[model samples]
Target: MFLIVEESGPWKVDAVKAGLTHSLADFRIVESRVSSVETEERIRLLVLGLLTKMSRVRPNNSASDGSSVDCEGHVGYEGEGEDVGRVGERRVNMGNKLSSKQKKKRKEKVASSLQIRNDFLTGRSLTTEREKCYDPRDRTLTFVNGDDDLDFLCEDFKSLRAKMSCGHAVTPMSLTNWCRRLLDQGECRFVCGQTDCHVEWPFEEVCKMALLTKEEMEYFEKTLFRNVAQDYLDVKVCPGCKSRVVRADLSELSVECTTCTAAKKRPYMFCWQCLREWRGPAPRSDRCENYGCINQPLETLRNCLHITFNDVRGVTGCPCIRACPTCGLLVEHNKTQCKNIICLRCKVEFCFVCLKLTEECLKSSTHFQACSTGVAPRQTSIPVWQRK
Candidate 1:
C-alpha cells in the first residue's frame, strides 16, 4: 500500500537537496541540522500535521498488517521501514501514468481544433471562421428605375438584380424562369439572357445566383446530368422501367435494359433509335425491326433543303437545317448573323456552311466567307445518337 500526495506546494531547500542526493524511491528524511534532537522533533511535528489533515478529510481503516488505509486507497504507516520506500516508488509510477494520459488528451484536442471542412464546389478547405464569412448572395447589383443604359427587359429586373460571373446582370425571377425554360426545352447549359453575350454559367454558380431551394436544386442537377449524358453518350430511356440506359456498342441499335430484365426475370431489349421494344434482329443499324422505325433527326439532316446565305456571297447550297456536330440537335440558320450559328440545346457554336466547329472553320476562313473545304458533305457515317 502507498500514500500518494499530489505535489501542489513549493519545495523547501532541504527537500530539494534530499531529492537530489537520494533515489526517487527513498522516503527517508535527511538530517540537515547538527542537533539530532531538533531534527527528530521537527520530523515528528511534520508527520503529526499530515496525519491530522488526512484524518479530517478521510475515514481511517486499519490494514491487517497494522497500516492505516483510507477510502481513497492511500496507506499511511506509523514507522519508518523498507515498506515506506516501496510505497514512494508506487506513487511515482501512478503520477507518471496520470501525466501520460493528460498529454494524450491534450494532443487529441489540438488535432481536432486544426481539422477543416472542404467546400463542395471549389474543392477548397474552409476553416470555421472563413466559412462564416462566405456568402454567395453578396454578389449583386443595384438597378435604378430610370437608368437608360440598362438593357434588361424583364419585369423583375429592377427588384432582383443578381450579377453573374460573366459581369452581366440578371434578375432572380428572370434567371429562374429562363433556366426552367431551358430544362423544359431539353437544353442542359444555362447561358446569359443578354443578347449576343451567351456566356454559359457553371451549375454550382447558377444555383447560388438563383437561390434555388433544395428540391429545385436536386431536380436541376438530375435533369442537367441526364441531358448532358444524352448529348455525349448513346443513352436512351427504357420503355418498361423508364430508367436511362447507355448503349455500349454504338454500331447496334438494340440496347438491353438490365433493370427491367431483372424485374421481369427475362432479358429485355429496346431500340436505341426509336425507344420502342426491340422487334428486329440483334445488330441492325439502319432501322429497328419495328415498322416505320427511323431516326427523325437524322432524316431531317439528310433530306433538308439547301439554303443560300442571303448576306454572304459564294456560300450557297448549304443545308437549310443542320444537326449540331456536338449534340445532334437540328438547328436552322437565321440567315441574319454570320455563317456561324449557336445550337440551342447544347449551346455549341458551329459553322453553318461546313458543319464543323466554328473555331476550326475560322482558322482558315472569315466569319462570312466560304468555308475552306466548301460545304461539308452530308454526314451519313455517324449515327444521329452519337456526338462528333
Candidate 2:
C-alpha cells in the first residue's frame, strides 16, 4: 500500500494504492484514503444539517424582529450555512416580483392607448387639422349645414343680398356694398332671390339687411329722397348752415331748421316758398317781398337744371363736375386758367385749388400757396353714366 497527498491552496487531495501484494510494481490505485473520505462526508452532512436549521430558524427570527432577512449566500446570526439553497430561493422570489410589476406596466400602457383611440373616434380631440375649415383672420362666421359649407367667398353679393332680406343667410360687408349700388341705381323695391318666393322688401328693410348704422341710414335717406329726386324733392337749403330741410305737411309757409336755430340763439324762420327771412306774418303774395326778388318755385330752384348723364369722354361726365364757389352755379372747368375761375353770375374770383375766394390770393400770384395738393387724386371706379 502507498499513499499520495496533493495540496492546492486551501483544498487537499489524498490517494491510496492497494494490490494483491505479489510485487511492488504490480500495485494499482484504488480509492481515496479512508480518513480523508470520512472527513469529507462528515463535513457535507454538517453543512446540510446547518442549512436545514437555518431555513427553519430564519422565519422565527424575522417574526420577532418585525423585518425580512435576506440570507442569499450570506452568513447570518449562526455564522455559516448552505449558500446554494439560499441563492436559488432568492432568484425564484425575485423573478416572481419582477414579473408582477412588468404585467402591471403593460396593462397601464394598453389602457392609455385605448383612451386615445376613443377620443379620436368620437371627434372629441383638439387637433390642428380641424382648424383649416375657418380662418381666424377674417373674423367671419361660417355657414355649415349637414352638407353645405359656405366660407367668405360664396355667391355674388347682390344675389346673396336678395337672399339675405328673406333671412336665408347672413351677408358680409361686400354684399352690403352691392345692395347700396342697386339702391343708387333707382331700384327702390327688392324681392327675394329664392325660387318661387315673392317677398317684396321696402327701402328701409334693405337698409336693415345691409346693417347700416343710424347715421348712415339717415344719410342714405337724404340722398335718395331729397337729392336724387328732381321733381319730388321738397327740401330747402338753410341759408345759415346750408343744411337741407323738408317742410311738414299742412304746416304754415314759414320754415325753421334746428341747426339754424341752435347757432343763431334766437328764433329764425324763413318763407318756405321763397326762402326769405320771415320777420312777421305776411299777406300771401306771389313771391316773398325780398328786394329784387322774382317769384320762382323752390322746387324748380332745387332741381338740377341741366343734368347730362353721358358725355363723349367718360372722364368729364361727372354730374358734379364743378360748382361756382361764389354763386353756387354748376360750372365745368373747360378753359385754360380754370384754377382762377371768375363766376359770370356773381362776378367773384375764386381759387379752384382751395375753393376759396381768390381775392385772398396775395399780389405775388401764389393762388395755391397754402393748399396741400401733394397727394395725387384717386381714380373713380364708377363709369360716367353711373356717376349721379
Candidate 3:
C-alpha cells in the first residue's frame, strides 16, 4: 500500500522528506505531495487519516506499483514508499528514553572530553613548568608563624608595612588610601581589622608613617620636639602665633619669640622666665631693662661674668646649676641678690638658702638665720635617747 501526501506548499513537501515523524505521530510520508490548498496542520491530519486507513486494508488488497496520488488527491501505489514508512515506524519505537541522572552523566562526559576555552568560570590550565601548586607550610618556602605570610603589598598607600599591635598587618600605602577615602566621607576614626583587638587607628601614628620623605620626616621630628618641650619642659608658646618659641637653651633668661619677631619685620624679643614681650633696645642690654623683673641673673649675664671670673666658671658645665624651687627648672643665677629667691614659674617666694620654702624668708629674719648654713644638720643625726 502507498500513502501519498499532497503538499499544500513547498514547506509541506520539505517537511515530509525531512523527518517530521515526531510531529506526524511516527508516520513518514510514502510519497510527497507537491500541490494542495490545505495548511500544514490540515495536511498532517489528512496524512494521519490515510495512514489509519492503510492499517485497516486487507492483506491481499495492496495498491499497484509506482502508482501515486496527483494534486486532485487520487490514491496511488509507489513500491518504495511503504518500506520507508515502516523503517521510520521501527526507529520511533526502538529509540530508548533516558533518565535524568543518565542525561547529566552523558553531558559531563562530553564536556570533559571537549577542549573548552577558559572563560574564568571553567578554570585555566597552568602552562608554566614551575606552575605546580605550592604549600606555604613547606619549610623551604616559609618559616613557621613567620611575618612573610603576614606581609602584603599596598601600592595605593605606597609603603611596606609591619604587623600592628593586634597582629594584623597592612601596608602604609593601603592605610593611607583607606584613610583618605574614609576622611572624604566624613569619617573620624577607623577600627583595626583584628576583631578581638578593636583598636582605633591612631591618627598621629598614621601621620608619622605617611610622612615617608626626608623633608617631611625632619619637619615631623622638629614639631614633635617642640611639642615635647612645650608640654613637658615648660617652654612658653608664642603670644602671636601660639607656636612654641625655639629655645636652644632652656636656662637662658631671655628669648626672642621667633614667631612674633618674624612679623612686623623687626626684632621682637621676650623674656623666657616671665613670658613678657620685651620692647625697644633693652633686649640688647647686659640685663633685662624691665624693672622689678625677677630675671636679674640672665644666662647672658652669667656667661659674661664667666669670661671675667676664671675661677668657679669651669666648675659646672652649665653656669646655672640651681633649679627653680617650685618648678625644678634650672635657673641661671649671677648671685647678685640675696639668697631669698622667688621662682619665676609658680612665683613661690622660696629661700635659695637651703632651698627652704618659707614666707618668713621674705618677711622675718629667723628663717634665714636657721637656713644660713645652707641645709640644716639632719635631725636623724641626733641620738634618739637625747631627743629634744
- Go through the candidates in order and give each one's C-alpha lDDT: 0.55, 0.39, 0.38
Residue pairs with backbone atoms closer than 3 Å in model 1 (clashes): none
Model 2 misplaced stretches (Cα beyond 4 Å): 1-174, 186-198, 201-234, 241-244, 249-252, 256-267, 279-285, 292-388
Ranking by lDDT: 1, 2, 3
What TM-score would each prediction reach against the true structure? Answer: 0.48, 0.27, 0.22
Of 1 and 3, the candidate ahead on TM-score is 1
- Give me the runs in candidate 3 sitting further than 4 Å from their true place: 1-227, 230-234, 249-251, 279-292, 295-388
Q: For model 1, how does the per-residue alpha-carbon lDDT over 126-168 read when each residue is reduced to its tens digit?
A: 3221101112223233422332122345342333344567776
Model 2 TM-score, 2 decimals: 0.27
Error of 2 at 4 (Å): 99
Best by lDDT: 1
lDDT digits (tens) for residues 34-136 of candidate 2: 1111123334533433222222122211222322222121223323333532432321333434577788996896676566444433333234311111111
Residue-level lDDT tens digits of model 3 in 82-112:
4332332321342478788878996886565
RMSD of candidate 3 to the truth, in angstroms, is 39.4
The full ranking of all candidates by TM-score, starting with the best, is 1, 2, 3
- Backbone clashes under 3 angstroms, per model: 0, 0, 5
Please give the TM-score that candidate 3 achieves against the real structure.
0.22
